[model samples]
Target: MTVTEVLRRFNRTYTQRIGVLEESFLGTGRPLAVSRLLFEIGSAGAVGVRELRELLDLDSGHLSRMLRRLEDDGLVATTVDGADRRRRLVSLTTAGQQAYDDLERRSDERASSLMAPLTPRQQERLADALATADLLVRAATVRLRQVGDDDPVAREATRRYVAELDDRFPAGFDPGPLAPEPDATWVVATSDGRPVAHGGLRPVPGRDDTAEIKRMWVDAGWRGAGLGTRMLRHLESLAREQGYRRVVLDTNGTLTGAIEMYERAGYARIDRYNDNPYAEAFFEKELSSAS
Candidate 1:
C-alpha cells in the first residue's frame, strides 16, 4: 500500500479500537468535562479545590459553579477547610458515589466493546501502540507547570534519571543525593496522570540567576518519541522566565540522540563546568530573546 493509504488505515483502525466515537463514554448525560471531574474527585475521597483546578486545568470560577450545582443536586458535599476556612474541600455524597460508579461501569463497558473485535495478538499490538502514543503526546503536551523541589514525583523522576545516567556514564555518575531544596524550577511530565518524563533548572552556584538543566529523563519506551526536545524546550522556557539569560546542560557522549537533539535545538558545545562525573559533553544556549 502507499504511505498515505497506510496512514489512513492506521487512523481509521485506531479510532475504532479506542472508543473515540462514544457519546455516553462516561455514563453521564453531562459533558465529559464535568463527568471527568466527578470521576477524578470520586477516586480521591476528598480532593482540594486547588488541586482539582490544577489537575483538570479548569477555571476556578467554572469549577466552583460545577461544584455548586453538584452540591445543590445532592451529588456532592462541600465543607470549609479545617486550616483555611476560606478554601473548600469537595467530597462525593452517597448519591454521587452511585452516579460515579454507574459512569465507571459504562466507561469500562465501552472500552471493552471497542477491543472485542480484535484478535488477542492484534489487541496486544494495538494496546502497545496506544500506550506509546499516549506517552509521546503527553510529553508534547506537558505544560511546564512549576513544581517545588520537594515534590515526591519530582524526586522520583530525579532518582530514575540519575540511575539511567549512572548506567550510561563511563566515569560513573553521582548527582549527589536527591536534593529537595535545590533552587530549581522543576517540571514533571505525565502520561494519563502518571509521571513519565522530567527535567529541571536550578542555580549554577555563584552565577546569580543562571540555571543549569538537570535530571533530564524520559521513560524507556518514550526515548525516540521527541521527549528530549520537548523537555529541553520546556526547561529553557522556564529558565528564561526566571531571568536566566543563558542555560547550560551536561550529558554523556553515550547519549548520542540527546546530544544531537541539543545541538540541533541551538545548544553549542561548551567546556565542562561542573564535577558531574557523567558529563562528557557540556552545552550552553543563550536566551536573551526567549519568550
Candidate 2:
C-alpha cells in the first residue's frame, strides 16, 4: 500500500486503540477534547483564553462552548484577567484539580495496561517509534511563509541562528556581513506561531539567474525532524518564483548535518562563491523553472 494509505490506517487503529473515539476518555466522563482542555489548564495552573485557543488550534466559538460547559460543571473557573480586562483567564476549580489528578493516574494506568502484554524489548521499541512519530507529526504541522528581513519574527530568528553558529564554529560567527539585501526574501517556519526555522534568498552578485540562500538555521529542538530540508525546499520554490534558475549556499565545515542535508538534496560542492570569512564550504543546485 502507499505510504499515505498506511499512515491513515495506522492513525485509525491508533486512535481507536487509545480510546480517543469514546465519549468518556480515561473514565473522566468528558469527551476527548474536554479532557485535553482540562489537562492543559491544570498543567498551566491558569491560561488565557486566547492562548488556550491557539495552543489547541480550536475555533473561538467552540472553545467558548467547552469552557462554558466546564464552568457549569464547576470543574473550571473563568475570570477577566486582572492584567488585561479584555482577556479571560481559565483555571481549574477545586473539583477540577481533583479531576485532573484522577485523569493523570488513570492515564498512567492505561499506558501500563497497553504495555503489559508486550515484552520489555517490544515496549522499548514502541516507545522509540512513538517518539519518532511525535516529532515527525509536529514537524509536518510547522508553517512556512515569506517575510521581509526587518520583520520582528524574522530578525529574532536571525539573531538566534547567529548565536547558535557562534557557539558551534571554532572561529565564531558574525552577523555583520551576513545581513540580507533589501530585495531579499526571508522565510520563517513557525510552529504554534513561534519561529523554529528561518532562511533567506537573495540575488547572487553579478549572476542574473542565481540566488544565494542565507541564514539557514533550525532551532536545536527541531533540527533532526526534516525541518531543514523543508526550509531548503521552500527557499528553492521562492527562488524559482523570483525567476532564478539556480540556488547557492555556504556553510561552516563544522555544520556537518547541514552539509549532509545539502548533498542529499542534490546540491553539488563548488568553489568559494563569496568572501564571507566564516564560510568553509559552498554548494549549488540547479532548479527547474517549474519548481
Candidate 3:
C-alpha cells in the first residue's frame, strides 16, 4: 500500500481498537468525546473551561454542548472562577469522580487485555511506536510564523536557547555578539501560542547573495520530534524569499546531533565562516531556487 493508505489503515485500526466508534466508552453510557473530557477534569481535579477547550482543540459550541451533556448527567459541575468571573472552571461531581475512576480502571484493563497477545518484545516495540507517533502528531500541530525581533515569545525562546547552549557547551557561552540585525528575518515555531522553537536569517557582512542562519533552537522536550529539521528548512525558505542564493551556519562541536542533522539536510562542511569564538564547525548550503 501507498504511504497515505498505510497511515489511514493504521488510523482506522487504532481507533477501532480504542473503542472510539462505540456509543458507550468504558461502559459509561457516553461517547469517547465526553468521557475524555471527564477524564481530563478528573485528572486535573479542576480546569478552566478555556484551558479545557484549548487542550482538547474543541470549538466553543462543541465544548459547551459536551459540558452541558456532562452537567445533565450529573457527572461534572461548572463554577464561575472567583478571581475571574468571566471564566468558568469545570470539576468532577461526586458521581463524576466515581465515573472517572471506573473509566480509568476499565481503560487500563482493556489496554492490558489488548496487549496480552503480544510478545514482550512486540509490546515494547508497540509502545515505542506509539510514543513516536504521539510526538510526530504534536510536531505536525506546531505553527511557524515570522515575527519582529522584539516579539516577546521569540525573545523568551531565544533566551531559553542561549541558556541551553551555556549548559551544553564545555565552557559557558556569551550572547553579546549574537544581536539581531535590522535586516534579518526571525521565525518562531509556536504551539498553543507558546513559542517552542526559533531560527533566523541575517545578511552576511557585505554579501548580498548569501545569508547566515542563526539562533536555531528547539525546546528540549520537542527535540526528537523533527522540529529542528522543520526550523532549518523554514529558515532556508525565508532566506530564499529574501533573495539569498546560499545559507551558512556554525555550531559548537559538542552539538553532535545538530551536526548530523545538518549533514543529512545537505549542508556541506565549510571553512570557518566567522570569528565566533565558540563555533567549532561551519556549514553551507546553496538554495535551488527562490519561489
Candidate 4:
C-alpha cells in the first residue's frame, strides 16, 4: 500500500480496535468524546472551560452541551474561576472522580489485553513504532501563522521566551520589550490553538534591504520536533516576501544549540551589528529568489 493508504488503514484499525465507534465506550453508556473529556478534566484536576475547548478543538456550543450533559449525570461541575471571574472552570465531582477511576481501570485492562498476544520483543518494537509515529504526526500537524506583535498569543510566547532566557543566562535577563518597529512581521507557531514557537522579521535601522530576525524561541518540549527549523525557515520566507535581500540574527554564546542551528541553516558568523549587551555572536544570510 501507499504511505497514505497505510496510514489510513492503521487509523481505521486502531479506532475500531479501541471501540471508538461504539455508542457506549468502555460500556459506560457515554460516547468516546464524553469519556475522553472526563479523562482530560480528571487528569488536570481543574481546568478552564476555554482551555478545554482549545485542548479538544471543540466548538463552544458543543462543549457547553457536553458540560450540561455531564452536569445532568452528576459527573462534572463548572464554577466561575476565583482569579478570573469572567471565565468558567470545570472539575470532577465525587461521582465523576469515581467514574474516572473506573475508566482508568478499564483502560489499563484493555491495554494489557491488547499486549497479551505480543511477544516481549514484538511489544518493544510496537512501542518504538508508536513513539516515532506520535512524534511525526505532531510535527506534521503543527501550524504556523503570522500575527500582530500585540496579539495575546504572540505576547504570551514572548513572555515565555524571555523567562527561559532569564533562567538559562549566567546573569539574569531582563524582560524588556522588543524595539517598536511598525514594519515588523510577527509569526507564531501553534498546535491545538497553543503557541509552541515564535519569531519575527523587522527592518534594520538604516538598511531597507536587510530584515533583522528577532524574538526567535521554541518551547523546550517542542525543540526536537524540527519546530525550530520550521520557525527559522518561516521567518526567512517572510523576509523574502517583504523584498529583503538579506537577513540577520544574533544569539548569546551560551546558546550553542541555537548557534549550531543557525550555522546549519546557511547563516554565517558576522561582526557585531548591534550593541545589544547580551548578544555574544551574530549571523547573517544573504537571501535570493531561489532561497
Top model number, lDDT? 4
Give lDDT tens digits, candidate 2, residues 164-230.
9989988787767555479888899877656899998889879999999988999998879999999
User: What global local distance difference test value does model 3 have?
Assistant: 0.89
Clashing pairs in 2: none
lDDT per residue as tens, model 4, 1-291:
998999999999999988899999978889999999999999999999988897888999999998898999999999999998999999999999999999999888888888889999999999989988886787788888889988878989998999999999999899576765678899998776688999988999899899999989999878777889999998999899889999999999999999989999999999999999899999999998787
lDDT of each: 0.79, 0.90, 0.89, 0.90
Total clashing residue pairs per candidate? 0, 0, 0, 0
Off by over 4 Å in 4: 148-152, 170-172, 175-183
RMSD of 3: 3.9
lDDT of 3 by residue, 117-149 (tens): 999999999999888887788899888988888
TM-score of 1: 0.64
Question: What's model 4's TM-score?
Answer: 0.88
Off by over 4 Å in 3: 42-54, 71-99, 137-142, 147-156, 174-184, 190-196, 203-208, 219-225, 269-277
Ranking by TM-score: 4, 2, 3, 1
Q: What are the runs in model 1 whose C-alpha is more than 4 Å off?
A: 1-29, 81-87, 145-198, 201-211, 219-223, 234-247, 251-272, 277-291
Q: Could you give the C-alpha RMSD of every candidate to the true structure, in order shown?
A: 5.7, 3.3, 3.9, 2.5
